[model samples]
Target: MAAKTEDLTELSNIISTNVKNYLSHVPTPPTLRPTPPVPVTDEVAAEAREQLLLACRRVISLVGGPIETVMGMSAAFHQTTAMKLAYDMKLAHNVPLDGSPIALGELAAKTGASEETIVRVMRALTLQDVFVETAPGYFAHTSGSAVIGIPGIEALIGHWTDESFASAPHISDALRENNFQPPEDSRKLAFNRAFDTNKNFFEYAYTEDKPMGARFSQAMTAAGTARGPYNLVAVYEPLRAAPKGTTLVDIGGGIGHVAIAAAQKFPNLNCVVQDIGMVVSEGRDGLPEELKDRVEFQENDFFKGQPIGGPGVYYYLRHILHDHPDPWVSLSRPISWEKGDSLGGILSHIASVMDSSSRILIDEDIMNEHMGPEGNKMTITLDFQMLVMCNGKERTEAQWAALLKSADERLVIEKVWRAKRNDSGIIEARLA
Candidate 1:
């Protein structure tokens, strides 16, 4: 056998060639929407983008200096912090959208921020390709900065900057105080420690202030925007396959997004969106007139017993489980688990009501088995966010399987449908 070797330069060259070739084959994306610059509409383009991005990252790491690399890692939070400040100051909104530039002093006056502060923050973002300095002292919106001014995206920025940022500092404290244990109660998590409150994030945001609750809802909508059409409904094939008039129970469904989507896609599939009393009421009112006949809203706490039960129905929970802490005990056979408290109790109740034909659909991000250098970054980041806010976590495939088995031995994993060009999956479970 011939001894073959590759140097860093050669590796970089190969990666660069691969990236260029991949990009060359794909159609060029527009600079802005309604013709979105993101190649999200095309599956092949999306996959190509993934490959190109990984290659580019590899090339950068292989060529970059160790000191500079470490410095960039250390200063990673600065970009987010500056972006947050930009959002806070409404810099994106103040900047001209028609390619004309706003002088630093004028922009500062509009935002009520100092000219010097505005210059520093704008310059920082400009370097990152967020905004652009067309002239020596004037700034204008780039494709990146323009989107943040939208109500939904701005709300998302506010939620992350104001709510999530507040909790970041307390994660270490919460971990240290609990002896590095995941706190059992959500109230004892990093968010509570940061604000010195007993209420959970949702409770604080929803009950304490109505406007904040509304913004949180908008923020969630905005957060999902990047995913485009690669949604839970698209991933869950059972909905399309089900017979007409099949009922889907969406438990803990906030504002009934999934149910609405399902009802719209599968006209014959009736949906019952269940959540807390307040959310249910809001959902009921917020539902479109066309969907009103197909989709209905109900008030029900999932921790309590199953509210509705029947054969051939699908109970859907999208992005719900990760907000809950790990199970404390098994639910197989019979156990002294209290109702209206934990997921085990809820699962047991659901199992008791489920027939062999019925299925429970969990649509969530199941973490990769081995989180490598090229692993999904959003899932990992969200896992920590869950940890800090609720002592919850994004579970791996094995963890999900184990959880289902532990919840109820009869609750077998029927299938896991992971979507192409997306990390989200639909895990369908049924009674054995």
Candidate 2:
């Protein structure tokens, strides 16, 4: 036993040392590159390169097994029935939004099941920290579960988990086909089979049963409301400081959350929230009566054309563009483009309205293949979900740059702001 313990200790030390050495050799990301390379003698450069290579190799050897273990655990957790059942139990228990402590018997009664079943589900969820069994049989909601309480959260989760939509179930087929078609094809088939129509997933969700549709809308509103404040503060605060009474247009601003928040944050800043007629109609009653005069909701479709007659400081788009594919010409055909003639075409139109000093802030996930572990995982998962549901794909920085260049010759990516909540990055562009 003593010898085995010593061996394990030595192994652990070796693993730690290798990881440190490996990380030390990682090349600086291109975005972080200096203007010019520092000159070094050939001998010294060669020695440094050799050391870096050796360190990386040693680190890989030490950590490869453990890394694979972590990846497996992640995959299993996402794809397991245990996880799904636990989520369902939590949702049905109504513990998250209820904001009250729940006893096991009460949870079981609420869910219309036996106490044993509820206990088992709670125990499983407890393992994932989705909920806590505070005192053996009583449970409380965890922070993780609160976010999922919003209406659209469960629908989105369900949509992703459906056997026909999940990429995990089709990954093997995708590998064999050497195509991204497996999930794509499955999504198309599922929607067609279920709804007998070719509508986008969100559109389908909107037209579904009362509870589900309401949930979807609520989820979207919740997501926008939760992130809207931060996004506005991150970009608008600086812009607001530059000049007072700057009119800001929020394109496709669902429910006017972004505009409302901005209005509250910058009392001097006039704002317009534009969307389709239905969304604007729904959002009308939610705005404070005082804000009604200042923050107006317009029935405008961006694809048809932007209408605020801007010379505003900035135009903001939050979580909007990822809903469509690139090559805006091809992408615009199937969808409604009433706001502007085309997705790319509208940018030119929006640019025409903007003054020389105006800027565009797009608050969406800017996919970075080399983002840190948590960010990479979440973005990649979202990317696949986009593909399956909307035929949309997340874009890397280069992809975004290309899209902007194609959209309008006058628009240029000035800088990108990374989201604090996750690995997402915001592309900030200026009219050139």
Candidate 3:
């Protein structure tokens, strides 16, 4: 126990030293640093951040020793609840934007929520360093709380706390009911169980619950933006000199941001951002005027076949494949997937249209072996969330290769356009 306690103490030291070290690096106001405020693209900074993440994970695991981690995680749901309440009540916005403190009463008045309730929610948030309490009743934003009220961010929170939150508690039930197997049917997942409807997540979002659907659309954009600005570093060279007159189809592309960015950089590439009707409409409306001729929005269902085929056509799928289980890439049973919505089904269409020169680019999180027992909890969290919301998953590199091959025997990955920043990137494939 002494050794365990010492380890925890060391993590606390890491925490204390980390703050001092990071702040020491930051230049004081009125004088900017020579280096970028955040060296997002720098390899050295990424390594530093990753070490910090490992330390944080160690502390998290250590917390389980002091207190049962299950209980700790269970109790943490209140933080989510409080956050949901805070966003719905506009508590983050009610605080003065310029860093001025607001009293509890003022916050309550702005949100039309009771002061008693406001205090409870604020108390929950402050413990997580979301909002700070300077005096007895006064509050200000911390880094965590400051971004809560941003437009797409608010919707992301809402989408998570609403349906996703509601479904998470049912994961065990969702699994046990399916004989602890990877369920191929979307409607049989936790989200359907939570909502007491047979509709799958997308059906529930767009048809059964339009408001949730709208929030989901906004949340997706917010989710992407939060990940980082659209990265084309992976496809920069090939896209810059894209095969002549290629109408690059961005399957399931939302608002066509990636496609738009691609068109601007790649003169030879024309793009058609294909999605459902609503997403197509939104993309068309938001597309920049200068790039309108270069990029076009077309209503298309990804589950259906690819529309165009030629000598060297391009198909780009960003963050799309992982949202499904590959029926062809079996879990408990080989050739198990019967659902038409499987990754194999989707890839089959693209493969059918591919010639030797034609390319398919999958931009997704490809999980890899990392430094710790449990690597990158965000990826794990997403994997579970997919199980809860859509009966989907994240995949390893081997699994990705298997999935593509399962789609078509001749399909082969030519390269991985890996970014310096993270494990997620574009996998470029062509017919063998």
User: Judged by TM-score, which candidate is best?
Assistant: 1
At residue 233, give the lDDT of candidate 1.
66
TM-score of each: 0.90, 0.69, 0.87
Candidate 1 residue-wise lDDT at 421? 70
Residue 391 lDDT in model 3? Answer: 77
Q: What's the number of clashes in each of the models?
A: 0, 14, 0
Q: Report the lDDT tens digits of candidate 1 across residue range 1-432.
A: 000212656555655665565566666633632122353556656665666566556556556867778899888778888988898898988887776788988998899999888888877888877888888998877788887888888898887788788898789888888798876677788898777777777777777766878888877766765666535567677677788888899887878876887788888699998887777887888899988888998887666567789899888877888887655323522222234333544566677789999998887888988755567778888998888877778988888888888788898889999867767788899998
Candidate 2 weakest lDDT stretch, 10 residues: 29-38
Model 2 per-residue lDDT tens digits across residues 122-217: 666667666666687787776555545544555555544442244344344433554534333222533444455555455555554445444555
Put down candidate 3 lDDT per residue, 1-432, tens digits, no spaces: 122343767767766665455545544321111111223444544554565666776777676575677777778778789988887788878897666789888888888999999889988988888888989999987767777777888898888888989898888887897688967777777888899988778777777787888788898887776766565633346777666567788898878878887887777778989888877888898888898778998887666567878878888888777776676222212221235333436788888877898888888877875534436667777888888898778878777888888878888888888766666777888899
Off by over 4 Å in 2: 1-106, 134-178, 181-196, 208-213, 224-229, 242-244, 329-332, 336-349, 369-375, 419-421
Q: Which residue pairs collide, candidate 3?
A: none
Q: Relative to the true structure, how large is the alpha-carbon lDDT of every model? A: 0.76, 0.60, 0.75
Q: What is the lDDT of residue 414 in candidate 1?
A: 94
| Candidate 3 residue-wise lDDT at 417 | 81
lDDT of 2: 0.60
Cα misplacement distance, residue 298 of candidate 3 (Å): 0.9
TM value for model 1:
0.90
